[model samples]
Target: MAAAMESGELSEVCYPQDNTSCRAPKQPPGQAMVIYFLLSSISLITTALNLFVIFTISYFRQLHTPTNLLLLSLSVSDLLVGVFLMPVEIIYIEVCWLLGDVACTLYYVADYIITSASVANMVLISVDRYMAICKPLSYLYYITNKTVHVVVSLSWLCSMAYRLLLLHDHLRKPGRSNSCIGECVVVISKMAGIVDLVFTFVLPILVILVLYVNVFVAAMTQVRRMHSHVDAIQSLRMVKKRELKAARTLGIVVAVFLICFCPYYSPTVAGKETLVDAATAAFEIWLTHFNSCLNPIIYALFYPWFRKCIKLIVTLQIFKPGSRDAKII
Candidate 1:
């Protein structure tokens, strides 16, 4: 029995001689297969959906609005989450990290950058919608394509910089948290975790909440104003209706973003240590990745252009000449 236990331990350890080595967590055959299928499905779905959005926005000239540009940035981040991060996570589920410590650090860095960009995109969307609904006349002047490009570029650059700062210790000394050979774990200090929670979750969410509330109020005011602007009442009503619909759609997106992200950060909110590992963090990690799959579905439900583009894409009609000028909207 003692020999059998020793053999099992040796199999799990990346380096048998090292006392301070990570042990790979094992799953039963049945559970492993189920998890493999579930995770792969999510990864594939996220990739495909986000890919569709990327192609649609990039190919169609008419879809190049400030709002769709923000969506394009978001879809790119979501695509990275699926194409790069999710597959590594799925592989990590079954075995020890055969990759070196540098790889481990890079993996975490990529994860942090992608997820941070996703959160930033959501905040941008909220701000865009607020501008469109609350200050329609000034929105065109203030929220032009050039400004949107700058905002999206800054969002990504900031996320990369912020995450680099946040994970500086791990990047500087990879495997600092690893006590075993096969383990890939990073323990964030309480102060750092709180800062992460604030920037990634709390602050962005508060911004979204505040902007959305104002958007709703403005939309309501537009609906209730029956006597103002007698000459342009009909045109004003049409514009307000369009803005209201957009606000509602974007509101749903923000709500889903919060739902998917909140639980992932609950431990921090509860003042618990933040530990990243295959075993403890898998559920939270996948829950957040699942949001990428949901975003395109939300677009399909709310945006007519997305549905039209999807049909063209599936039918391979997007391959034809002049498809860039296709009147999708």
Candidate 2:
């Protein structure tokens, strides 16, 4: 028995009758159950939290603003990650790709589109906060709800187009990258990987960092100026404080996103082609998806409005008439 195991004779094939099928990894039954429970828990929590965020912003009229609109777009993308991407990944953790090659290709296409949309939404949020902080005078003029709506629509459209183009090869020839019958893999060439890294990760992160730095400086300057104006209008002071606090909260969201995604792109950063195979890239893939779970948690911790919204949601208060007009912020 020991010799058979060592000689690969005891290895499990994804398809017992198919000689060319991929070998399934050996996982203890007890360990598999534990992993399934943990991953399923993450998926449930992520879906529930992002749903709250979506409902809070969408249902409350008072929460409808350019910034909240950007957040709403973000929540939608994160919700998709929780609902769709994470569950698929959990399946990949312990199973062969039995869904066929075309399905595998389509799955990755959706994954890329959702991820790109999430990053685009983060960029939009940073731009919104920067305008509110550094360009306050013209913020309302430039960052209206209509404008945000258009921008968010364009972001999603662009994400779809970009991902489709990026994965055109895979779309053209499903299973081209897979080495075995039951394997689902996408091998990105070095050049394509570099381009993806630059647009999706490097450029967006740099823009976010630069915008937040300017926002931080401007916020500090405004705080000092308001303090020196001992007779500043009370309402004006309150508005400034609110904007500053928002910037800080969104900064945390961006920071957490960066932390979660950096490791996933580390191979690309090191000049390697990005090979995305569920069997081999489980840790990095799950880490990035975990960001979806963290975003709503950050909001719940930092935003009082979110906590209030949660209370209303849990107690079924949102179904009440006039709840839409309730003060959320």
Candidate 3:
């Protein structure tokens, strides 16, 4: 475990004893073991919940709305990561990517595809909400069923194209490339790195923020205009809650990208060798897994219906106890 952490597979922080100058908490083996246990649980729980969300939504026709469609897309992305990415991470923790190059490529591409698609979905959702709140008059036309399908399809297509470029340039080569034998296999090209950040992290985040900021501002303005909505106060408050929750979700996602991916890769992309060293590497992977792990918690907290559904599913009242599927509304 210490060896894995030291290899930058976890985060960039060294064990407290290794770097005396480090101000980080000294993780006792016992405490570290607990963290591992909790994180492992989180990975499994988040993944299962994400899959359930996707399955449940698909399992019910009444829940098929455009907004829910975007949510489904996000859930699918998380589901892929939880099933495909997290398990590999667990393996990497136990052993380096002993998988062959082809297998590694598949896993790497799967992670990239899902993560990139997640970013795109967030941006798409922000735009959807922005139009719904800011331009309600045309939202029905602007965000039609056909449009939703196109947008969602385009999101996946673009992410796939972006990843293929990375795969072609990076993963094709092994030891000579920026990546070690396995892992993300990020190539050692500054331009490629910059492009990746721009497309995957920077641009998506900027778009999400701009659209959601407009949405939030529009919501506030609309709220103020409801000066005499005395009978509608409860409904208006509910609207505000949903809008605020959406904004918070977007913010948390962008924050996760920055904290997890940007710092971890930026220094390496910039040829800062030590940043990819023991201390930072350990922190990066830990935070990266955390990004996938926290989405369900955020959804369960902010989404009332999701919370209720989770409760029902857990209690075995929503589906047969030993069944492979759920029946959530």
Best model number under TM-score: 2
Write model 2 residue lDDT over 1-329, tens digit each, in one string.
88878556635778767778988865799998999899999999999999989988999999999999999999999999999999988888788889999999999999999999999999999999999989988997888999999999999999999999999999999999998988889988888888899999999999999999999999888878878885856677799889989999999999999999998898888899788987778888898999999999999999999899889888998789998998888
- Cα lDDT for residue 107, candidate 2: 93
Q: For candidate 1, list the clashing residue pairs, or say none.
A: 20-179, 21-179, 21-180, 21-181, 22-180, 22-181
Candidate 2 or 3, higher lDDT? 2
Q: Which one wins by TM-score: 1 or 3? A: 1
Ranking 2 against 3 by TM-score, winner? 2
**Global CA lDDT computed for model 1:** 0.89
List ranges where model 1 is wrong by over 4 Å. 1-9, 17-19, 226-232
Give the TM-score of each candidate.
Answer: 0.94, 0.95, 0.75
Q: What's the lDDT for all of these models?
A: 0.89, 0.90, 0.65
lDDT of 1 by residue, 61-81 (tens): 999999999999999998998
Query: Which window of 10 residues has the lowest lDDT sum in candidate 2?
Result: 4-13
Better of 1 and 3 by lDDT: 1
Best by lDDT: 2
**Rank order (by TM-score, best first):** 2, 1, 3
RMSD (Å) of each candidate, 1 decimal: 2.0, 2.2, 8.1
